[model samples]
Target: MLNSINTNPGALLALQNLNATNTELSTTQGRINTGKKIANAKDNGAIWSMAKMQSASSQSLNAVKDSLQRGQSTIDVALAAGDTVTDLLMKMKEKALAASDTSLNTASLKALKSDFESLRDQIQKAADNATFNGISLANGKTAKLVFLANADGGSFTVNAQTLGLAGLGLSLTATFSTASDAKTMIAKITDALQTATNKLSSLGTSSVGLDTHLTFVGKLQDSLDAGVGNLVDADLAKESAKLQSLQTKQQLGVQALSIANQSPQTILSLFKG
Candidate 1:
């Protein structure tokens, strides 16, 4: 099927070479502009699937980090309130000792009792108000926090147990009327202070444990983020180098196609002979 007019083999070959060069140039340009080997899901289904999984995992890790931060803050508030309550209880104990001394007159003893009552009220107030994000960490309220790890299929829960004055057996309702009664109240207050101290000590330990866990969770989140970044993030330096190389190859490809088309042009000179 060779029925064509003015079909100089040189022109036909030049047109074909030009078309191929243009296609290669367009592809290289697209890659340079997009800065990705597979910019769309259709380009590389497997890579895209893995990238989506990494993205989902990164989001989950961020959520866990937020939860751990809130937990740490709650524990911090509870520990501070516990310290305040402990201090007030110690002051009340001192007042009780003063009231028990008969050397102090009735008026002085009555004032001392009033001061002790005020301190007890303060202790209860602190316990009641120790809260974080509307979640009370003190006053014997229980809460459980959980952390999930996807890779290891591991999880752990942290419980906020009773760390209140009542839990420490510190009864703030005891009455001190007579000097002897005041002495008995002082013993009770002293014992309660010791109990509260021990509980605060325990709370301190628990708070430290929570802090440690939070730190561990934070590190894990960071590592997960890094992993996700590695999966999908672009290497700008490498991409830039590739862009330069591709541009040079595209230029050379065009020149080579021009030379290939001219190979058939040598036949035109034979016709002149």
Candidate 2:
């Protein structure tokens, strides 16, 4: 109630309240602008730190996904080539069976031999061309390929299979020159077919494994993103409502301060009277 010119308690109290309202208004405005309640360490240190750590982990999974995808592609290439070789071996078996017939003419036998050789060469070509990223799983040269599986430094190892002619125990000079030779050729072709089939199965299994893990990694990354959002994301609806209230409070605070500033003038009126 004391209205001294030098010391006005009412004005001081009004200023204090106005300053408080201004601080609240500033905080609400910041939340609205950034769309985050914990935009930085200053907002909420513990929550912000947790969100940042999870975000980094989610980003790291991107590299893991890339590695898994690359591994899958390589295996797919090998599988395709192996399948081609298997089909070629089946055709060679047909040619060899025909060549083994004792009644066949020389011209027919020569034609069968030519066809068989062409198929064998094609199988070798398939193995040679089954390369992806400089890695040929069917060429009997590449070692086991490893891909990152998760954020914990774990990995998936894809074992490579030997699918080339020599690797499959098939000699390049294997021929059907006579009935006996044709029977030997038949055995070699059958063995090669079996080997190629097994290799394809192995590669197919690895592809499936990579695919399943990739799906899991994607889901885990999504969960991490959601967790980070829960920690730091702002509720725009709530912030909007709070912003309106704070703006109104700030206006009222300014008016109250104005009225308190006029209390000193009342002392001048008292002296005049």
The C-alpha TM-scores of every prediction are 0.79, 0.96
lDDT of 2 by residue, 208-259 (tens): 9999999999999999999999999999999999999999999999999999
**CA shift of 130, model 2, Å:** 0.7
**Model 2 misplacement above 4 A:** none
TM-score, model 1 to reference: 0.79
Which is the leading candidate under TM-score? 2
| Alpha carbon lDDT at 172, candidate 1 | 60
Q: List residue ranges in candidate 1 displaced over 4 A.
A: 1-44, 143-156, 161-165
Q: How would you encode candidate 1's per-residue C-alpha lDDT over 163-266 as one tens digit per residue?
A: 45576566667658878888888887777778767766765676676677667767776776677556555566776676577667657766766765566566
Candidate 1, overall lDDT? 0.69
Worst 10 residues of 1 by lDDT: 1-10
